[model samples]
Target chain A: MIRTAVIVFPGSNCDRDMKVAMEAVTGSPVAMVWHGDAEVPACDVMVLPGGFSYGDYLRCGAMAAKSPIMRDVIAKAKAGTPLLGVCNGFQVLLETGLLPGALMRNASLKFICRDVHMTCDNNETFFTNCYRKGEVVTIPIAHHDGNYFASDDDVARLEGDGRVVFRYSDAVGNATPEANPNGSVANIAGISDATGRIVGMMPHPERLFEKALGGTDGRRVFESALFSVTEATT
Target chain B: MKAHIKITLKPGVLDPQGKAIEHALGSLGFNGVDEVRQGKFIEVELAEMDEASARAAVEQMCEKLLANTVIENYAYELVA
Candidate 1:
């Protein structure tokens, strides 16, 4: 059985969604870990769900990144545990230095909440193995600071390493300027660490996992992680 | 001691809010505006009495939490 842990920070509104989605997919109870805890339970996957953590003080995820639980999360991620950070969780990952780059205010300077098309740039990672590379999927994004920025060299390196997991794209899979939702560098919507075990993305997969909610496109993300973990263990 | 901190986005990093403010000024008939880059100002009260220690602490704070060095540059001044 695949076990999952969902870190819950104060003001994190999407923790419940993560818990529900993981349970629904894995058929196992997920542990809801408080941000104050120093250690996380043994689990196959860890998820940092979306929300206004620590009221998004100082910066979007600056305050929460320093939480006690993050130290353990960092250690676990470094040890090859699958870690997925969505939305505000992505901000926390960047602030914690687990992921390179910074999320700045959107070019439009507006809180955008809508469905956007993104092409799966790489599907070999633990978090995206279920997706076919270059497949276009629609996911909902709701944030004001989802514009991803990195140094020119870093962007080139990420692209070269095939670590750019997803890119904003049109319905037909063309990554056009008009398809860019938040002015992210090179139309990047999500990225992974060099090892591909740690992934951070601005889109919330848990929010769109069920067809009743909207669509099932996001379910494959969790399925992919679970499949990867199960494959590694077996 | 108080540490006055100024955090500004690094040169070449896009600042959408600053650009919006610049456009607003243009609409208000203010001419000759070159560009606008927005930043943050923070005042932190330090319990340390020694000037050197306070300065060091403030610098660490800027590096660790107050400012994200990835896209921002921070400068600070200590005042009695």
Candidate 2:
């Protein structure tokens, strides 16, 4: 059985939800690693779930990014372990330098809470392989600081390298100004690093995985990543 | 030694809060307030005796934790 670990800081409110979601799909126990711990422990995939880590002090994920366990997380990331960071987790990954770009205050300066449509930009990566290219998926986004910022050089590099995985779009999957919920550059809802092993995104895919809640479009993110890893290993 | 650090977003970066403040000031009939930008002020006390070393330490802190240099710039002054 493969293991997945979910890192939990003091103020993390989504760790349990993520754990339940992963367990339901993977049929294995997911470890909830504490922020104060020095080691992340060995896991196939490590998750940094969304929440107000460190009570959103200084910055959304700043203090939590410097927490003790991050040293291990960074090491593992460098050694090629796949990582998925959601919402606040995305901010933390940016702060940790595992992923590029900073998530600033939303352009509206107000907390956005609603479902947003996103399109799969690249289905070749381990995380999005389950969805066809340009597939539209509905995911809930809840945050005040989901605006992504990056230097022009890096943006060009990311685009050229095919690292942008998801972009906000309309119901028909058209990228437009009105479709951009938080003013992210190019309507990027999620991005993968150059290696495509790590992903950070602002949407809450775990929150609406079951159709009973609203939609099951979010399930393929985990399923596809699983397919990629298990197939590669075999 | 005491270090006072100020962190501000780069000029090109959008400051929504600052913009809101500017709008509020305009509504209050304040004249000639062309632009307003906001930043953070952080004060830290350290026991380093040497000024050069204190400045170096604070600069390192700014790079590592005090400020995110990617979008924000930070400057520190040593006091007393």
Candidate 3:
């Protein structure tokens, strides 16, 4: 069985939703690890769900990044535990230094909540193994500070290293200015760590994991990642 | 001891909030506002007595938490 745990911080409105998504697909009980804890239970995959952690005060993810549980998350992340951060969770990853770059306010200076197309840039990572290269998928994004920014040189390095896993794209999978919803640098919508064990993105893949949710495109991400975790044990 | 910290976005970074503030000022009839870059100012009171020591402590805080070096820079002054 693929063990799963979801980290829950204060004001994490989506923690239950993330748990529902993981359990629905994985058929495994997911633990809700509180931010006050020092460590998460043993699990194959750990998810950092979206929400206003610590009310997003002191900079979106700043305060939460200093939480006690995050200290353990950071240590294990370095030891190679698979982690997936979604939306505000992505902000936490950046603040924890587990991922590169920073998320600033959207160029339009507004909170955007809508479905956007994303092209799978690299399918070799654990989280995206089921995706075909360059395939376009629909996912929902809702955030005020989703604009991804990094130094030009750092952007180049990420591209060169193939850590970039997804890019905002049009319906036809073409990366265009109009298709970029958040003005992220290089149209990057998602990326993985150099080890490919950690993935962070602003979109809520767990939000559309079922047909009733209007799209099943997001199911494969959870399924693909869980499969890898289960496969590793056997 | 009181420490004043100013946090600003690094050069060349896009500041949408600052831009929005600038536009709002323009609409309110504030002229000659070529640009307006918004930042944060923080005043911290510490029990430390030495001015130099307090400034150094606050500077460390800036580097560690008050600022995100990836996109922002921080400057601090210690007041007696």
Name the best candidate (by lDDT): 1
In angstroms, the error of model 3 at A93 is 0.2
Question: Can you tell me the DockQ of model 3?
Answer: 0.82
Q: Rank the candidates by TM-score, best first.
A: 1, 2, 3
Least accurate 10 contiguous residues by lDDT in model 2 chain A? A221-230
- Clashing residue pairs found in predicted model 1: none
Q: Indicate whether candidate 1 or candidate 3 has the larger lDDT.
A: 1
How large is the i-RMS for each model, in angstroms? Answer: 0.5, 0.6, 0.8
**Regions of candidate 1 where Cα sits further than 4 Å from its true position:** none
Q: On a 0 to 100 scale, what is the lDDT of residue A35 in model 1?
A: 97
Candidate 1 structure quality by residue, lDDT tens digits, A56-97: 999999999999999999999999888999999999999999
DockQ of each: 0.94, 0.79, 0.82
Tens digit of lDDT per residue, candidate 3, span A32-73? Answer: 999999998888888899999999887888888889999888
lDDT of 2 by residue, B40-80 (tens): 99999999579988988999999998788779999889899
> Residue by residue across A83-118, what tens digits does model 2's lDDT show?
999999999999998888899999999999999999
Which of 1 and 3 is ahead in TM-score? 1
CAPRI-wise, candidate 2 is: medium
Q: Is the docking of candidate 1 incorrect, acceptable, medium or high quality?
A: high
Clashing residue pairs in candidate 3 (N, C-alpha, C atoms within 3 angstroms): none
